[model samples]
Target chain A: MDIKSLKNYLYWLYCQFELITCSYLMEPWEKLLFYTFNITMLVMVLYTAYIFVPVHISTAFQFFLHLLGNQHENTVSVVK
Target chain B: MANPSAVCNGHLHHHHQKQNNLLKSGIYKKNGITKGMKKNGVSNGTLHKKTITEHFEQAPMYVAVLTFLGFGVGTIFGYLRDFMRAWGLEKRNVAAEREQQKDFVPLYQDFENFYTRNLYMRIRDNWNRPICSVPGPQFDLMERVTDDYNWTFRFTGRTIKNVINMGSYNYLGFAETDVNALKTVTIELQKYGTGICSTRQEMGSLDKHVELEKLVAKFLGVEDAMVFGMGFATNSMNIPALVGKGCLILSDELNHTSLVLGARLSGATIRIFKHNNMQSLEKLLRDAIIYGQPRSRRAWRKILILVEGIYSMEGSIVRLPEIVFLKKKYKAYLYLDEAHSIGAVGATGRGVVEYFGMSPDDVDVLMGTFTKSFGAAGGYIAGKKDLVDFLRTHSHSAVYATSMCPPVAEQIIRAMKCLMGLDGTTQGLQRVRQLGKNTRYFRRRLHEMGFIIYGNDDSPVVPLLLYMPGKIGAFARRMLEKNIGVVVVGFPATPITESRARFCVSAAHTREMLDTVLNALDELGDFLHLKYSRYSKSSHPELYEETRLELED
Candidate 1:
């Protein structure tokens, strides 16, 4: 998932291997199915990030506020 | 303080003379004369050039991967924090942030300070650490502590003493004034107080300023030179004076920010070539000549090539010989900035020109700063008399900015005299030789330790790559805790994965001192998993054996 290994992997795919299955072996219907699956998966990940992050962040914020309520001045100089 | 070093310098000078005689006679194959100054000397008239910069090696794949992953995770966390603040789930302590402006648009964007709050805050203490002594080989850093996740810091009333200063650009040890230079500086102080409070172009050109300029011209082997008050302004102001409207500036992409600002302000059409890549430069030069200016199709008013003697961040020396050839072929003007390399480079310390065994006339403009190697406050431009004459009236630094301080000028004069052997001693030679030796030894040791470092092996700015952003702060903190000062850079200044800690090796560093710092680095490397190199320099295969599976494999 890191940039460099991904680059090397792509370089290997582009230089050493031929795109046989996707370019030649796949039928029109299968190709359409593959494209649909990829598009849907990417959209789903983006959608989850859009919807779930706010809730997770609000909970974390509430916890932080609760944790720092009473001894705000002392904790301000002592801890995070 | 000075006598022992003078004695050491005398011994080294004699040894150098004996080796020089042998080298000329072809008795020896050039081994110990100087590590990085080998084969290229003013005595020899040719430069041995390299295609790609050799010493700046790439790190192992894992370091890059880990760095990106850290940044990605950090970015996601940053977004989450931003969302929390924007949606009012988390409230800022500031009263203004809590106030709502009814029937009006919000004045501030919530994510405006996202990078600062989310990313930089986590590791902000690594930089801008205040030091309380002369930034020589050893200095004192005032310690401070932070609470509430680096939102603010308060001084702890403690100073870290005897901290080995590997972070400063005091290359020739000029920042540390010895007894001899101190006496002369005091005399100059009485004569000229601190500063003249006027511009050189107005009334501030004193005897000391004139003498310093003449000495600088002689030291650089140029016809004339002009002094300026500030180093950054030396380029940012003077470049506009030289080139403007429709002029083409073929600048290196890795050129300094000052140079970038100067080029932009010049109102010139700037074309960038890959750093030190002669092929890319040649392609640009050819296209520029063929294409000429935009729309109208006339030739550019002038083609000026801008490059630095040694790029400070990358620690790479300019391919000056090759660049000169390209300049001559394209009939372009050459502007060389030796800010970091002036008194620190070359066999005779004349800079990149002397290092390449090329004549001063090979370069059209010779620009450098006294702030680095000279350990003074200003900069200078030296070339032909015409260039200096034109810059005298036209350059903003010369015309508007106040003249350089008198004592600073005297310091530069004394330092330049020592560099040119006018002080009737070889201490300058010894310093240059020591710096070259220190640089090579330091780089060789880092390479042997399996740490990836950038720049020429001879260049004093040794950037040791830490790669991981997390390790950037970790390395600096650990080194400080071990009583060593280091400078680390991440993100904005460099590509995220190329985060590094740059060690500016100086002639002032003793072998024992360097070894102590190296020992600290070795322990840190082991703990931090920083040994990322697959190759080792000549020896230390055993060191590589320990990190092989953990790193490259």
Candidate 2:
């Protein structure tokens, strides 16, 4: 909903992929690494939701509009 | 003070005090700010849980809607990114095509455009899908099973149960997995570990390599033999050592590409004669010996006549006796490439020399490979003891490249022993006989059906002419749909107009299998209008007249 929550979600997704990749690697401590990652992800998601939701929603709307406009311009030029 | 704002300020002050303690411990940095109040002053664990529960309950519908929107928008953006990449690639390809058209020959430009836009891309896109995995006789292939008019490709899982194999080079069926030669290989692998880890001149030569070389020399009836780690390199790398700038080479016009490379690499003056034409070969040899060379008029230090025991493309066996007579008459050393003929043609599989009743000693240098007939991997140079010793020291392949692995060498030795009847069994003799019989039978059957086939009747590599360009792909696909794996060659591999499907007969195939293939081919022949019988109107007067009358109407 908000910029902070979105940022937290993206970071969580990045960490999830990292955990998956680490699991694929031939590491002895992969299970331990995944356990630590799961605990940290829960704390981050809740903390960001509690403190930063309202302020970020407004800022996130502006950033989203800017991103859409930039991509539209890029697609037009590339097509030409 | 009894003010409403006073209560809010008091709660905020308490939260700020707790935040200060947490911030001092280096937490809540990426979350921007943690200046907020919870309903109660609880422990950190309880507080964290309370925050999560409160946030979710506060706006359940809002969270769900935003979550869905995030996923939807992310997917759309990802697809747009891929689309943009593809659009850029098309533009680049178009520009490249325009530049190529301007710079290249028209035929080459046309070929480039066709491959880039059509054939090559289709091959790359469907590379893994259409081609069967573990390619061999009776391989596992994907079959389209129709269920209630809706069709889907399904893996049969059972080695294409009854599929006829006309694709592999397993001529005597020696390459089949169930051969006893593999037992020796397994034992050799355990003894020698996997590879020798060095060139033959170094420490790569094991006792197996020496034993195999001796076995090859004994089998070919030569004084000595030297084996190479690779078949292609055996010819390509060894030619330079045998011939040099002062020498001249008379090669067959239709010799294999590896032979061509070896001749070119030698830097010798190369002359190509009409394929298997004894008169053309004699003329080239006589001219080289009498006139010396065209430009320099310098006497050629030596003359080498290069020919294959069997021409792979045309499936024609070489006129070895005539060629040998010319080689003797002109004083040119003969180089016979027996890559396909070895373990295939003769009664005991001694190759074309034996097939023609000529002695192996008559040829100066015999070049053959174990890849085809021996069901192993490697090649050899069999000749006089002095020549073999010379090549061992001078040949780049022997000196620089790693020697053949022990297991492969052992397998080749076993195959040769079996062929020589040293294994005390007639299985190898039986396979050789069966292959010869199958080849003639299949070729005769094709002739009887009125389909045009190329190559000697006894040659296993038979190419049935498709002639039409579009039919190359169509014929192959149709045959595959009928569960036959066939090798088709077009354009660059063969003459542009002479596209054909090459069928190799293996000893593994039975008479019944060959009969089934003939039946399937007859149906395909009529459907594709490929049969000469269809074209021969006199033979089928009624059908021809009906077609002619229909055309007139």
For DockQ, the strongest prediction is: 1
- Among all windows of ten consecutive residues in candidate 1 chain B, which has the lowest summed lDDT? B10-19
Candidate 1 interface RMSD value: 18.0
For TM-score, the strongest prediction is: 1
Give the DockQ (2 decimals) of all models: 0.01, 0.01
Q: Taking the true A–B contacts (Cα pairs closer than 8 Å), what share appears in each candidate?
A: 0.00, 0.00
lDDT score of residue B419 within candidate 1: 74
lDDT of 1 at B42: 24
lDDT string for model 2 (B1-553, tens) is 1121132232223323322433242443433222222233222322122211000012234333433443343234334433554567322233333444766654433544543343323222112334454344566555544231121235545444446678878887776566455788788899997797899999888888889988787677667899998999999999899999989999999898889999999999999999788888888888887899778899899899899987777788888867877877778899999999998886678788767545566799999999887777889999878899999999999889998989888888877777666776767777887788778778766766777677776688888876554355557767877877777775566664465788888887887777788888988886665664333434423343453364354
Residue pairs in candidate 1 whose N, alpha carbon or C atoms collide under 3 angstroms: none
In candidate 1, residue B533 scores what lDDT? Answer: 82
lDDT of 1 at B280: 95
TM-score of chain A of each: 0.46, 0.30
